[model samples]
Target: MNITDLKIKAAQIRIDLMTMITAAQAGHTGGSLSNTDILTALYYRVMKHNPTNSKDENRDRFIASKGHSVESLWCILADLGYFPKEELTTFSQFGTRLIGHPNNKVSGIEMNTGALGHGLAISVGMALAGKRGGKTYKVYCLMGDGEQTEGSIWEAAMAGAHYKLGNLIGIIDLNGLQISGKTSDVLSSEPLDEKWRAFGWHVIEIDGNDIEQLISTFDMIDHKSDKPTLILAKTTKGKGVSFAENQISWHHIVPTVEQLNLATIELRQQIEALRKEEN
Candidate 1:
């Protein structure tokens, strides 16, 4: 998809996730909205994936380390036909594979994530295995800034560089806020770029919400380098909705009926604007 199309797709995804969350009456609203464009850029434009052949060996892999903000992923997977889009209504319901977190039982999910910092570790293992097996597949892991506080993430960072797993791409959603409050206030993971560089990974920073920037940055990743790459994606929590954007309470709060309606209108307008730009 072109830049305009990607932007439109992202807006629709934001609308879809918000509706799903409101219907389910639960979700990580702020973080999911913040990272919607990042996920859209990957799944729709950058990543090599197939919904019909979910287990294709050579396909690129994506691991959502910040698993709590999985609403955008679930919507994307369903839109891509990994499962029937109708099943989205069952999200977070009893006995549904589409629970609050990413479940490996789901067709496109790589691992059962949500345990905070384990994603990069597992991604390093996948990238290393892919290299050893002589496969060209790449592994991409999306993490939240709040998740950076996990010690395991740093350990995995070291392992990734030591292994020279260039095929491993780790993206941090630097939305600046977490469930409690501002990420800076909760745990200062500042100097994130310098820290990753010191850890021996190539670091790139960009506006995570900008689809064009996301596509360009992702395209620049070197899959055969001796060092892994880390994308410090600065984003805004609750992006795309005026009332919710950057509000900490929305980090995990389900939107009320009125809020959902307003959000839908805002996103739909964005979609329409993007479509016009496409022309």
Candidate 2:
């Protein structure tokens, strides 16, 4: 898909995310909204995978280390037909596999995530496995800035570099906020570029919410380097929704009916604008 197509698709994904969260009556709304564009561009335009053949060994693997935002992943996976769209309404309900966080049972989910610091560690293992097995598949891990404070993340970073896992790509959703407060106030992960570079990973920073920037950045992945890649995707906490943008309160609130209506209208306007541009 073209950049314009991915932009439109991302807008619709936000709409679906809102609907899913509103229906569930609870979710990590801010993080989910913040990460939507990254997920959309990957699933729709970058990743090499087939929903019908999800278990294909040669396919790329995507792991959401910051799994609180599984709502975005769920919406994308369902839309891609990895699972039925009807199952989305069951999110957060009892006995539903589509709970607040991802589980391996979910059709397209590569691993069960939600223990904030575990995802990157797991991705390192998968990437190493690919290396050992002589597989051509790449492994991508989505992490949050807040999750960076975890010692395990740095440990995995060192491991990836040690192994020279060039096929492993780590993308951090640098949304500037986490659940408690601003990430800087909570735990500063500053000097990010130098930190990752020193750990032996190639780093690139860009606006995560810009579909065109995302497409081009993905194309710039360098597999020839002996180092892994890290993308610092600077993004807004709650993107797309007007009132929710960068608002900490929306981090986990179920939007009131009025708020949902307002968000829906705002997102609809954006979608329409994109549609007109397409025409």
Candidate 3:
């Protein structure tokens, strides 16, 4: 897909996120919004998966390490026809499969995750499994900047590099803000890019919201041969919603009806503009 088309799809995902969270009345809106573009770039353009057979053995894998942002994954999975979009309304409610965190019970969900720093390790195992089976499928994991504080992340990093699991690609959602405050103030992961490189992984940084850059970066990663790839995607905490943008407090807050309407309008406007550009 072209950059403009990707942008439009991202806007639609953002809109779907807003609408789903609003209807469900509970979710991690901020993180969900922040990571929409990255997820869109993966599910729509980068990852190789068959929605009709979500568990296909040779399909690419995606692990949501920052699983609190499952709403974005849920919305995109629904868009990809993993489940009915109408099921999103049951999110976080009693007896709902669409919980705030991802559950593999849902089709197309590769891992059940919510705890921080677990995804990379799981992805390493998946990549190792693929290699053992002589499969060409790749494994991708998206982790939050805050989640890096967990020591297990670095351990998994070292293991991935040691194993030379070049089929594994880890993308960090560097939105800066976490639930409590700025990630730097909460726990500094300064020199993040250098840290990954020192661990023997190939690292690249990009504006997470830019679909073109994201697509290009994914293509670049696909051509890499030896080391595991890590993309440090700098993003706004509550992207595309004016009121929630960069606000840490919005991390798990459900949008008020007024706020939801405003977000929906902004996303629609963005989508319209992208469509105009295409025309």
Candidate 4:
């Protein structure tokens, strides 16, 4: 999809995520919204993978380390025909695979991820393997800025640099908000770019919420570099809905009917505006 179509798709994904969260009555709303465009850029534009041949050995690998916000990921996976879209309604229900976190049981998901700070480690290993095997696949990992506070994340960071996993890409949803409050207030992970560079990563910073920027930055990834790449994607929590954006309380709050209605209207307006530009 072109940039305009991708923008509309991201907005539609926001609406779908909100609808699922409202129906399930639970989800990581703010973080999901913040990471929406990042995921859209990957699944729709950057990454090479097939929903039909999900097990293809050469397919790109993606891990959502910040698994609490699987609503957006789930929506994109379902839409890609990875699974039945109807399965979305069963999200968070008893005996359903579409729980709050991602699992290997999900067709398109590469690994079972929920524990904070694990995604990078897994991606590092996968990238190393791909390098050794001379495979065409690349590994991408997504995490929240708050998640970087975990010691395991740094451990993986060190490994990524040591191994020079060029095929590996790490992206942080730097929305500055987590469940408790501002990420800095909870556990500051600022100066992220400098820190990643210090750890031997080639870092790129961009507005994660902007589809065009996200696409362009991903395109600029040095897939042939001897060092791993880290994208500090500055984003706004709860991005699409006016009332929820950047508000900490919405981090994992399930929207009420009124709130959901408002979000639906807002996202629809955004989609319409994007479509108008396309026309």
Candidate 5:
């Protein structure tokens, strides 16, 4: 899809996320909203995968390490025809396949993630397997800034660089906010880019919500070899919705009916504006 079209699709995903969360009455609303654009860019543009055969060995992989944002992933997967869109309404309810975190039991999900710091290790294994089998598939992992505090992340980072897993890309959703408070206030990872570089991974920083920058960065990753890529994507915690943007309180808060209505309206306006630009 063209960048403009992708932007519109991202807006739609934001709309779906808000609606699904409101209906479920429980979800990680802030993280889902913050990560929507990056997820949209990956599914619709960056990743190479067969929606018809999600298990295809040669297909690219995506592990959402920030698994609380599973609502956004589920909405995108449904939109991509991975499952029936109706199933999204059952999210967080009893007997629903769309759990708050991803489970590999689902047709399109690659890993069961939510615990943070686990994705990089899994991604390293995937990359190593691809290399051993002489397969050309790539592995991508999306992690939150808060998750960086886990020592496991650095351990996996060392492993990936040691193995020279150039086919692996780790994108950090550096929104600078975690559940308790601002990430810096909690645990300062001041020199984030330098830290990744020291680990021997190629680092790129970009505005996570900017579609053009995301596309360009992904393209750069596609061209890089012999070193893993790390994209430090600076983003707003609760993006798109006015009441939620940059507010840590909405991290797990269920939006009130009025708030949901206003959010939907705001998203619709953004979508319409993008559509007009396209026309």
Candidate 6:
């Protein structure tokens, strides 16, 4: 898909995830909205993934380290035919595989995440194994900014660089706010670029919500280099929705009936505008 098409797809994804969260009455709303564009760009354009063969060894691997914000991932996987879209309604419900976090039982999910700090470590292992096996696949791990506070993340960061796993790509959804409040206030991981650089990884910063920037940055990465790459994707907490954008409470709140209707209308407008631009 072109840039315009990708934007439209992202807007639709926002709508889909919002509806899912509202229906389920549970989700990491702000984080999911913040990372929708990043996920869209990866799944639709950058990553080498196959819905028909979820276990294709050659396909790239994606780990959601900040896994609570999985509503968007679930919606995207379903849309891509990893599972039936109708199953989305069962999300977070009793006896459903589509729980609040990433479940490996689900066809497209690589790991069971949501522990906050273990994703990067697991990704490091996967990348190292792929390197040793002479596999060409890349491991992309998406982590939340709040998750950077965990000592384990830094440990994985050091290992990723120590092994010089160029195929290991880490993306932080630096949406500023977490469930508590702004990340800076919660536990600042400021000077994030310098910190990653100190860890011996190549660092790149970009607008996380911008599909164009996300795609271009991924394209420009040298996955074969001697250093791992970290993308500091800066974004608003609750993107796309007027009332929710940058609001901390939206981190884990389910949209009220009125809020859901308003958000849907706003996102549909964006979708329509992008569709017209596509034409």
The backbone clash count of each candidate, in order, is: 0, 0, 0, 0, 0, 0
Candidate 6 per-residue C-alpha lDDT over 77-133 given as tens digits, one digit per residue, 9 for 90 to 100: 999999999999999999999999999999999999999999999999999999999
User: Model 5: per-residue lDDT, tens digit, 1-279?
Assistant: 999998889889988988998998999999998998899999999888987999999999999988988888999999999989888889889998889999888888998999989999999999989987898888999999999989999999999999999999999999988999999999987689999999999999999999889998998775348899999999998899888999989889998889989999999999889988888
Q: Write the per-residue lDDT of candidate 4 for residues 68-105, one digit (tens) a residue.
A: 98999999999899999999999999999999999888
- With a 3 Å backbone cut-off (N, CA, C), the pairs that clash in candidate 2 are none
Off by over 4 Å in 5: 222-224
Model 4, C-alpha of 26: deviation from truth (Å):
1.3
**Winning model by lDDT:** 6
lDDT for each candidate structure: 0.94, 0.91, 0.90, 0.92, 0.91, 0.95
Give TM-scores for every candidate, taking all chains together and pairing residue i with residue i.
0.99, 0.98, 0.97, 0.99, 0.98, 0.99
lDDT of 5: 0.91
For candidate 3, list the clashing residue pairs, or say none. Answer: none
Model 2, 1-279: lDDT tens digits are 887778878888888889988988989999999999999989998899999999999999999999989999999999999999999999999999998888998778899998988998899999999989989998999999999999999999999999999889999999999888999999899988899999999999999999889989988888766899999999998899978899988889888788888888998899889889889
Tell me how candidate 4 scores on lDDT: 0.92
What lDDT does candidate 6 reach at residue 245?
Answer: 92
Provide the global lDDT of candidate 3 against the true structure.
0.90
What TM-score should be assigned to candidate 4? 0.99
Question: Which ten contiguous residues of candidate 3 have the minimum total lDDT?
Answer: 218-227
lDDT by residue (2-30, candidate 3, tens digit) is 78888888888888888888888888989
Worst 10 residues of 2 by lDDT: 2-11
